[model samples]
Target chain A: MASTRAVLIWGALAVAVIVPVAIAAHSPLLAWRSPVYIAAGLAGVVAMTLVLFQPLLVGGYLPGLPRPRGRRLHRWVGAALVTAVALHVAGLWLTSPPDVIDALLFVSPTPFSAWGVIAMWTVFAAASLAALRRRLRLRPRVWRLGHTALVMVVVLGSVVHALLIEGTMGTVSKVVLCALILAVTVKVLLDLRTWALLARSWR
Target chain B: MTREHATRRAFLATGAAAVATLATAASGLLVPARAQGLAPTPSMRGGANNYLPGAPIVERIGGGGFWMTGSVRRAGDGAPLQGVRIQIWAHTTEGHERDPHSHGATLTDAQGRFRLEMPQIVPAFGQPHGHLAYDDAAFETVFLRPVMPSSRDTSLSADFVLQPA
Candidate 1:
């Protein structure tokens, strides 16, 4: 019975992710949209989807993978997520330099631009911190606190950015992905018991 | 009342009317001229179509085996729109955005259905989005459709219902 329940849970998770993506694949706003823009849009979506996996991996939610393996995968996935983000921004830059410039400056007229930039920076910061953790000789607890905080910023900003952009991404799928990202992130953070260390640090 | 005052008043009124007319004309020019019907914005990243000027404007391709099928219909009446010229292009299976084999155009049949036989596309940008354009300039054009990849067959299908022009 327990195994059956686990299978059902995993099945639900897969459906939650796949069904939305399938729906998104069905309706693209334009039939002849430029490949570059399509690529950029796809990169953004891929990056956002990767956010969901981060929590799953970190929380050891995947059945076969042990927590150590999950952590290793989480690191690799994080790198992939960052790469996706870079490609997204770079692709957009190639398509429209002026818009990318405006977005970078945080002066783009589009509301979504600001959020995207924020998310982009946060992701970079998280990656940078991860790379520097050993060099900085930071305590594990301290590192966790900072990393967790940055991850939160990344997820929140990304969610807002994705939600705001009325682009090629199917609306229902994008929303479901964003909601799951937030929910899973929160759940993983709670499960990791980061709060206890963070709270104790305050004293 | 006085002849001089009446003439001055008439001149001022005529000047005001002329200014108003000029202002209206200027504002009309300032308003962005929309394309006939609803035309979607072009892709920012110039794709294969942008570079391939020598390519055929309309190709007699898209039939069987590996294909993309769709129907164009009137949104309100549920009527199929026949003879609508539809252009389509995608990244080739090898993932070249500029591949010629992935580009073509055809007309919809009487049933408002079109079948485009394209290469087994490898989505270079993550997921493949096939670019499309309708022949009628007066109807609003839908730009891109995310063509779902299938493992079982090298075929995909989509339907377009156009808004009233």
Candidate 2:
């Protein structure tokens, strides 16, 4: 029964990620788009799904992966997430530099662009801190608190960014994916007792 | 004495009327004349994306059974501008909007009107919409993405009143 449940959960996760990419692949809008643009766009779609995996793996929600192994996978996934973000931004930069500049400067007329920029920066900050953790010689508690906070921001910013953009993504599937990312993250954070850490830190 | 006062008052009123008439005429002259008695259509924000700078002209998008139609007129005077190239693209039944097969360009006829037939527009980005653009040196470029009222609509029409560059 448990094995069947694990298979079902994994399958569900697969659908959540695969459905958006599939929808985008068939988007009639792709006809005139540059290859760089398509690659960049798919990277974004993948990154949003990756956001879901971070919390699930860190919280050890997946049955097959042990917590320590899951944490290691989480780190790899984090690196992948950052790489995907770079591809997304780079593709846009190549396609439309002015728009990307506007987004980076936080002066974009489109609300979604700003959200995306915010999420991108937060993800980078989290990645940088992770890389420098040993050099900083921070305590486990401090590291967890800081990383968890940034990850939460990444979740919020990315979800808002994804939701606001009206792009190749299908509406129903996109909303479902965003909602799942949010709910799962919140659940994982709660299970991990993020608030208790905060309380202890305050004391 | 009362007759003299009345005459002075009449002279002031005539001057005021004359001044008002000239101001109205000047204002009309200052504003670009609209021959069609219609205001220029403002471009929508976020209307242009996946725009191809210069897609070649095509006779039709793809065995076009569904009509995508619109008119183009000058903003200064609601005069139809002929020989203007108008590009049309849409997510359609045969191909995605991003496909080269899904995009095509046509010229405005002498009447300042343009039309093309393409496969029926499919829901793209969640709504059934068609994109049209007037990217030429002759007029300020305008990109339009107009949504059809219903996915089942057989045809969609969008018109443009372009400002001179």
Candidate 3:
């Protein structure tokens, strides 16, 4: 019975995030837009939403998820985040190559473009560094510091970018999601007690 | 997990989902189209016919902003066709679709050359594209390929080769 209940809870949590985004996408302004553009925009929203999941998984905050399983899922979700970002950029590129190029070059006239680009590269960099962590033989403390720093960049940049773009995303839902993402991330960082660990090690 | 704990978890999870859904819906969040099987139109379509017949002719060359250069030609003969009318409409720097300054036209020179200057437009979403059209006496209205912005501050070029229809 408990196991069944756990499954129910997990399902509900997933639905909560998805249903809102699905409903928020139905705007009259988007009626005439192309599928490629829609896909690009949706991918960005998904990527930003995924940020909320990362901290939860890493902190083992989800009910019934073991730490090991949560960590594994965290890695998988991080990779998925990268793929979403790629698809977001690729779909946009298909719709307009010049605009994509400008965003990538950090010369786009939109303020959101630069922030989005920064978050995108930081996500890629974080993933690459994580993959090389074992090979690089870095100390856990050093790795944690670098990874935490990049995560902050990803979170801050993504939040700003999403907020600045007054596009199809429903403003209320977007703000709520962003706020949750920031709160969860900060909570996870505090739970890690990285500073405490570093200070103890130094002593 | 114990039966009691499981029940509590389920209750909390269900409550969370319900709250989120209600809040989002109350805030007017509605997804219009499903993601799958959308029949997307090609990016380039005909330019908007917003050009007034007696609209004042504007010389786009040497004006500020991005410069666009192109030539009108006969499709089959590869011959430069002079005096073709080219129309352009683009989003403003603020990304407004109804921008007045972004809509205008110019006539091809003796060498079938035309130039247009436009502001650096940034779309709120998707990609920014400039609409274009070419008109010649002997050919059907030719909509030139869209003029897109690039990474560098450089001139954009397009050539309209109109087919007789």
Q: Looking at candidate 2, what is the lDDT of residue B14?
A: 92
How high a TM-score does candidate 3 get?
0.57
| Tens-digit lDDT track of model 2 for B61-125 | 88888898889998766889899998888767676555678788889999999988888886543
Clashes of 2: 9
Off by over 4 Å in 1: A201-203, B1-165
Ranking by lDDT: 2, 3, 1
TM-scores for all candidates: the values are 0.54, 0.64, 0.57
What DockQ do the predictions score, one after another?
0.03, 0.08, 0.04
Q: State model 2's lDDT.
A: 0.82
Tens digits of per-residue lDDT for model 3 on B1-165?
A: 446545777999999999999987866545433332223222243234233232245765223487667887665456676777777655444323333555667888888898877655443353344556654456666554353554243456777767654
Comparing 1 and 3 on TM-score, the stronger one: 3
> Per-residue CA lDDT of candidate 3, range A1-203, in tens?
87787788678667647754775488544554467777888888888878888988999878866678999999999999999999999987876566677788876656788999999999998888898999999788788888888989999999999897756677777888888889889999899876665676542
Please give the C-alpha DockQ score of model 2.
Answer: 0.08
Which 10 consecutive residues of model 3 chain A have the lowest summed lDDT? Answer: A24-33
Model 3 misplaced stretches (Cα beyond 4 Å) = A1-12, A197-203, B1-87, B91-165
